[model samples]
Target chain A: MTQTALAETRTAEQGMAAHARAWLDANLPDALREDRPSTRRNTVAELCDWEAKLHRAGLVGATWPKEYGGGGLGLRAHLDISREIGRTPMPESVNSIGKELAGPIIMAVGRPEQKAEYLPAILEMRDIWCQGFSEPNAGSDLAGLRTRAVQTADGWVVNGQKIWTSGASKSRRCLLLARTGPVEDRHRGLVLFALRTDTPGVDIREIQSIDGERSFCEVFLNNVVIPEEDMLGSPDEGWAAATRVLSIERATNRMHRAWRFENQLNHLVSACLSDPATRHLAESTYRRALAEVSVNIELLKGHVETLVGSLIDGQEIGPRGSLPKLFWSEAHQGFARLALEIVSQFPVEASDTLRVARKRMEDIYLKSRAETIYAGTTEIQLDIISKRILQLKRKA
Target chain B: MTTDTELNPEDFVETARAVTTACAEAAGLPERMDLLAEAGLTGILAPEAVGGMDLPLGFAVPVLRAAGGGFLAAPLLECMLLARAFAGVDDALASAIVSGEMPVTVAWSGMLGGTSGVVGRAPLAEACARVLVLGADEGGVLVTPGEGAMVETESTLDLERPEARVRVTAASGPELSADAVARLRADALVLRAALILGAAEDCLSRAADYAQERVQFGRPLSANQSIQHHLARDCLAVETIRNNIHRSLSPECAVPAAAARATFVGAATLGARVAESAIQVHGGMGFTWEVPLHRHLRMIKALAAQGGAADLIEAVAADLLANAA
Candidate 1:
């Protein structure tokens, strides 16, 4: 392309980003803003409605195909939208599993009919999806999952228990992974199903998490009959599909996180500054720590932007995604701890903003503990970096 | 010297690595400067009129990276900045510095007031023919140390290139505007970030190689989970620094000064941590002078101090607080 074309492309992207920023500023209500003291506890229906509105505004699913109720503006525009969403202290997507993980994998390996059916519904927020990859014994060793799915004359019958299935209680669909072969076949003979959660034998029980949210659930599939059309791909394609989902989960899933991290930091500082007793926490007492947090936020942004650029250039992220995964988890956890410490010091007569910040930070601190534990544990990320990225040989 | 339009910075990396490696064996400062000038590195950021390529500061990053990795004792970063600063203001001195005739270093701390003042943190000031100091008016002044000026070597963490305190009783040279000084300071932060990143990469490479070769407890040290985790963390830190540096240099950076300062501070702090981990990976041999891991660690510490990481952090914090809404 000529230099003029390149300049034009940049101008267009900047215009799109500016439009997104302005749209979000005008649309997002203060009652839904996480950073605002007036924010109320939004219900699942309210959050889902807001997300669907975001989709309508082209702020969500910007990269999904236009045939699937998406804007189809491409990854750069998606990133621009995500950045705008992140800059504001808005709530996380209630159906992120559907949009980020399940939707992308379905696009990759789903049948055309499946994509036509599931993709649009996901974007429309009509079908909330929950991932069913982790089992009682297969959290990190996902391939060792023992969920049995035997094909009967009618359909496929699945009997298994999945743990840590976030949003399962509210989800309408499950991206369930089950094995068709014996236990010895670790990665082979596995099958993925877009199982309906309201199926007769399927049971979902909420598990209260440390953050006092019952988002995490234990999904029990007892002779749950799944239709043949619901199979994601071929029987042996499950491992590949699962790995693809995991990699996306590690890399580009929720690309707004780094920006959100910065928003959280700014919220903490702003809250501290709202009160005389707490102002010194950000001004002088914990200045170095706050500065370190600011620096770490930049590093996290660097990682995310670099990955996005690489993806746009058609380069495979592969295990290189673990870098940001490890860095952000550890760094954000540190920031959460620091934020809690600062907010915990607020006086009894602190400002309402400080009280709201304290509550938000307390939840963040509790939820951050699971950040490293989930999305492949810190140890798993380290192992991937050492073995896959560094290619270090294992002990003989 | 080549014109800026005719040169590509990526094309100079191999030559820079080779020349800087050769400089380690050079007899003295002049030979080192000669080697660097021969490779066209000294004039990379200077003007074509002053016999320089007049390329962007990005062109000098690879050269300084090589210098830092090879531990070349000459004041290359200082010379490049000084030569660029003197380009139009004093073409003769810029030409001299670029042609390896006059070796120069910059006093990163203290300002020269009236006729004399003490300036410190000038690396290899005793070996250089000229030193650049900030003036009281926030401009830049080139000082040719002579009878009235005294150079005092300050014991520092970096033994090979200890910073010097120059007491300038009489100084006179071409003056640079305040804008030039500010630009030079920002440029210095970026270049130092690149240098520290290079040193950290070298340390990581050496540590990984040693871990693979060294056998302990009936297996290679790399097999140990603890050792592998350490090296992996170092790799993450190194990549973070590299990415941050690139981001700071990219045109998309919103605030170039703040980005550059963040890059320098991140590189210094994380680069030192990486070096420390590299030493731990090497066991006892890493602590000895023969191993040379300590040199990179020392250089990183000195760079952090010289760049005023603590003060930068405070400034960053102050900005964050003041912007609170």
Candidate 2:
């Protein structure tokens, strides 16, 4: 494109962003958009409706191919949409597993028939997917998962249990990992499946998290049948497919997370400004901590931009993907911890705003603890950097 | 943001790196400065009209990093900051330095003042044509010819860059505005931070090499999990400093001071850690002067004290508090 044409295209993108900002302002429900703890609840039906509206507005899947119900735009469009989404204090997207993870994986490696079958429902939030990868024995060593899937005449029978399954209780479908060969076969023996959560002999029991939420659960499978067509790729291609999904998970979701982090800091800063009492609670130490958090958040933002840039340029993040994952997770956890420290210092009979802030801070602190553990532990991340990116030799 | 007369940063950095590599084997400051001036790094930040690259301070960061990586003897970092300080305020001196006709070193006592007091130690003072004394105000800076100033050489840990105590008469030289002084200070910190980062990266790279080659118990030292984790964490700290530096240099960051301060403090502090770990990874050989790992360690120690983290933290706290209030 010519210089003027490029400028015009940028202007048009900015215009789309402005329109998105206005649309989100007009459409997002007050409760979902509000900062109060009471409004923080994610009611399933309402969130599903919101997701459908978002998909209709072309904001939910802007970077996905147009044939698969996305806006068929580039990364710039997604960034624009993210900037607007960051404005509202909305809860997590109710169907994030389907929308972010499963959808991307299906698009990248799934058969065309699988894409046609899964992508639209995911965009519409009609098929909520929860990951069933981490099992009782295979938290970090995911290849060790013993969720066995025996091939039957017309399908596969899955049996075994997955632990720490987020959104398992509310999900309609699952992106699962089950062993197709002997348990000792490790990664090569694993297969990825898209299984209906309501299938017979499948059990999802909610596990109360530290924050007293039942979002995470344990999924047990006993002869739960998955059709041959439901296999994500060829049998035994689960590790490759899951690696792609994890890379997408680390790259794409972070824009919103980074913005949310910014919003959280802004809210705290505003609160500290408005109430001398709140400011006095932690005083200089609090301000210093806030400063530290701000600098680190900007660092994370910069790191994310680099990662996303690599993605935009069609460069594989490869082992370098671990850098952003490690940086953002630690930055987020540190920010949440700072919030908790500030909030716990709030005086009794605090205003409703302080109370709400305290509650959210509590939730963030608890939720942040898992950030390092899930989606690859901090230890695992360091290992990847050391052995893969840094090319350090592993012990025999 | 680049004028047609401006140097392309990539080309500039490449040329700077070549000069750096060539100067790596040379022992003396004059010889190194000749190579550096040939590459135009001594005037990299000066406008092209004066035979300089006329590049922004951000562009000069890599050159500083490369210089720091090799422990080059040229006063490029000091020259770049001084050139930028004198850019609009004192074009004559800036132009002279930009033209590579003069080599200048800066003394950060507190700020520019004409008062007869000890200017903070000037690095490689004997090698420069002039020493610029910085005080609280821009106009407060006194530029004294390098030889005319009362100078006391001090033995320091960072032997690569010699340090000296200089006393100058109060208000003796051309003064700059406070705005100019602040910009100059920020630029100086950024260059120093990049240097620290470069030195730290070299430390890590050397340690990794040592770990890979040095065997223990029939395996490479890196084969040990403890060593792997140590290097990994140090690598993260280095990456953090790198990210902060890049962020600080970006156009959109409204307050570069925080990022600069963060990078400065982070680089020095973490650079020290990496240097220390690098020594440990080398076993007893690291303790010997022959290993050269101790040079990075000493530089990091010197840098850590250059601009105290306490002041940066105070500034951040005060800014955040003021914004909150």
Candidate 3:
């Protein structure tokens, strides 16, 4: 290799390693407490405190433009930070909406004043946010959502309910996507607003899910009064923004989740260590699967980093982002299911490692179960691959 | 063998696809014998400067996938895998392999939970000069195929990658360096996975086609939601394996062989399930020897047992987890 090229590569690696180490050390939780899979709000809040630390340190939202009190680093920095944060079992950052989805979209579409009012608050955790998009009637058929927004001279009045709103009960703001077009224009006529969860007409009630975390809540927007400065993006632009938002979630987040699964896989390895034969056998199978998962994660990371690089250079990812999301989600599910199969015979809390291991598997299994269901289901991912990537004709 | 920086995966895949397609059209696994020698596939470790394709795992993987599909019934992969421990350093042997003149065999003896050195018959025993052996420690050795280098044909699941019983007295050839043995063990995985890729693809397409055309009740089996879902699930499984293979195909040995082991082992295990379902789709025809589905069933089982599938993938996972970044 040429000296100059070699120098450039070394500098990049050193910088990334330093950036990655800083984030990993600061964000990983100091401890892992639950023997059972836990996503309780308490766990989430503790995770948020780390984000608040990162916010204070100028590491969180470093990808955002510096005008909004962000670090304004590149995608490599963003990925390195995320990769590092995965080293620990900390709670998922509560400001996930702002740091991940809402911030990126708001930057693209929010009016200058709206940006000034909301962006800084979100980055600093002065206000927490939740997405009020999916409703009871709309899950996979998201465009069919019936939430309606009536235009007012001042702003818009929303009169509908959004269910499965993660963090709605605690959030200070909602990136509420409501229908503004005719009933038939399923996707086209939508508008987004940054309405306060504490607004007079807003009501939130937590629901019990299979995991029993109470992480998601139902939000009833009864004539929720929103202001003119609160609209996120242009009117009728919500669908596009939401789609971009989902695609971004698919690309950026799944890599770290895959990395986190490696820890669970490690615990599984320690399970069979006492028995040389089983250790040989168990470690053999699990190690190989872990290696395979690691390789795929690297591939996915490389892919997303490439896309983000192109985007930084003014390129769009098109529909291929679905490939990694679908692949990793299923891959994770397989990894989790494989863990259960390997260690099911162990008492629910056999080895401390096994007990710790079981919780990891269940958490990932639960999360992975959503992979094929959300960020587009497996079927949806396939459709995207077929129609968008391969451009295969739809069979009659 | 050398890593070809100039070759992209797409290009390697294209070459492999063409090669395998031609083989598939002709003799499936039955044709593997002549094809390996004809294509010089049994000599991948020979330097490209000496006439080999000289590719890393990425190039090797696609070729294996193609060969697996082609059902080229030969000890081609076994030869190349063992040959990794024999090339360059053994000038005469490597030169013969580069010229498509050397044929070799990989005898596990004690690898993959085997004891007393159970082995398969090698085609090159009487012809070519060298034979590679996975030793008592699961390490590999390249020894001469002369004198007490015994070879006997054992009953094999897939006739394509021929298996035989081998018994060696006190025979010896030029010993391989430790590094060569590691490379051989790793490539053994890639070789095994490549074959599974072909087998899995064969099973998936056949199952999908059968579901569309076969009729059980009034509706075509394809119309059955259960069947559609199964087929769709199988398609996803197959894609995951393929994705695993793609990642495995880099010049960097970090993932290729490891992924090959995990993916091939996983594919082989799950692939057998698909093959069983494939048979069910054909009803009675699936069981009868006249139908071709049994071949895949046999091949899948056969590949799963080869190159130490379970142990390798588990080891790979453990190592990866140990070094988590």
Candidate 4:
């Protein structure tokens, strides 16, 4: 690119970020802002509506093709928008599974019809997706799953029990992973389906979690029939396609998380300063710990931005994605713990802000317990780093 | 004799590596300084008018990294920083330092009160004629040892080039502005982080190579899951520090001050941890003087102590609190 063209591109990117910041600042309701004392619990419908608005404003799916209800911007623009989104304390997307996972996979290996059908629906918040890769017998060892799909004259029959299926109760579709081969054929003959969750014999039961949310569900696929057209890719292509999408998603998904982590830290400090009894928490007493947390936050941002740069350079993330996943999960969990400890020390006569911070921090601390357990687990990430990135040998 | 515009910072990597390796094998400080000046590394960030490259600060990163990784026992970072600090203010001195005609080191800690005070953490001060220290007003002043100043070596973890405590009976030199002092300190933090990163990277490579080659119980140590995990964590830590350093240098950093301090503290803390892990992977061999793993650890700890990691951490916390909404 010429110097002038490069300068123009930079200006345009800056405009993209400025536009996102302005739009979000103007549109995001105070009631949904997590940093505000007036913030209240938002209904799922309200969150979905807010997300659809974000899409209409070109704040969501900025990099997805324009033909698929997206802004058709470059990945840099998408990253710029994500930073703005993260700087604000907005709620997480209610359909992250649909937009980040299902949408990307369909775009990659989906039939043209599948992309046309599912991609726009995800951007418009018309569908919520629940991943079905984990089963009662397989969590981190995803390939060890026994969820079997048998092809018959009518369609494929899927019979399995999936545990920890987050958002299963509200999902319109399931990104179902099942084996078409024998049970012993781990990671082979695995097929993926955009299975309709309301199909006959499909049951969803909510599981109450530590944070008092029933967002997690146990899904029973009792001979549920999935049409042949719903299969994401050709037979036996599921494992490869899913892994590819997962590797990218692990790196690029939730790009705003680092910014949001900063937002949380800022909120904790501001809340502590709002009350006389809690002011010391933000003062010299917890200074070193807070500084350490601040460093971790910067490191997390560094990991994220570095990954974004590599991706923009057309480099394959592969197992290197495990770095950010491992760092963010562990660091965010630590921050959550620290935030909880500070909030727990609030005096009996606390300010309204302190109470709200205590409540949010309590939820954050409880929910963080699952952060390391999810997304391939801390142990799984460590194993991948050592075995793949480091290529450490194993004993014969 | 390439001008700053003719070369990118990355172009210096191979040259820096080669020169640093040569310096490591050189007999004494003068030989090492000559090697650095001959390669134009000592003046990497100095002004072109002073017979220097006048390159950006990024140009010094690779040189420092090579120096640290190769265990080049010279005050190269301090010289580069001091040369830049002296440029324009004392062009002759800058030119001298850049040309390897005069050796100078900076005392990272302590300030001169009135005309005399004790300033410490001057690396290899005995070999240098002058030492730079913070003045009473928090600016920078250059003091010539034995010309109304004295140097006392304080032997520490790094035995090869122990740091010195300088006592100035009379201070006389060109004074750097407060802004220049702050900029120099911030730049020092970044350069120090890069140096520590290089040392840690070398240690990690050594450990990984040893693990793959050293066998135990009919299998190489790399084959063991525990060793693999240990090395993996060290790799992650090293990568994190690298990323943090890059972030500190990026133009998009929103809070450069906080970011620089964080990078330094992160590097100091995590760099030492990685060094310890590398030593562990080497087993008893690492504890021996011949392995050289202890040298890297010593450097990391000594650097961390030089700037006082706890103080940096608290300052970072104070900054965050001060900026709190």
* Top-DockQ candidate index: 1
Error of 1 at A217 (Å): 0.6
What's the fnat for candidate 1, on a 0 to 1 scale? 0.56
Instruction: Report the C-alpha lDDT of model 4 over B165-258, residue by residue, as the tens digit.
Output: 9988888877888888888888999999989989999999999889999999999999988898898889899999888888788776666777
Rank all candidate structures by their DockQ, best first, as comma-separated numbers: 1, 4, 2, 3
DockQ of 4: 0.66
lDDT of 3 by residue, B54-92 (tens): 555555666677766666554567656544445556767
lDDT of 4 at B228: 87
TM-score of each: 0.96, 0.89, 0.79, 0.95
Tell me how each candidate scores on DockQ against the true complex.
0.67, 0.48, 0.15, 0.66
* Superposition error at A180 for model 3 (Å): 2.0
Docking level for model 4: medium
Better of 1 and 2 by TM-score: 1
lDDT string, candidate 4, A1-396, tens digits: 678876776676668989999999899998898766764568888898999999999899888887999876677888889989998988898899998998998988998899999999998989989998888889999879998899999999998899999999989999989999887998789999999999999999999998888998999989899999999897777568878989989998999998888888888898888877778888957777887888898888888887888888799999989998889999999999888888889987887888878887888899899999998888888899888988877874
Ranking 1 against 2 by DockQ, winner = 1
User: RMSD in angstroms, candidate 1?
Assistant: 2.3
Q: Which ten residues in a row have the lowest lDDT in candidate 4 chain A?
A: A33-42
Looking at model 1, residue B91 earns an lDDT score of 92
lDDT digits (tens) for residues A217-252 of candidate 3 = 999989887987788877777557667766766667
Deviation (Å) of B218 in candidate 1: 0.7
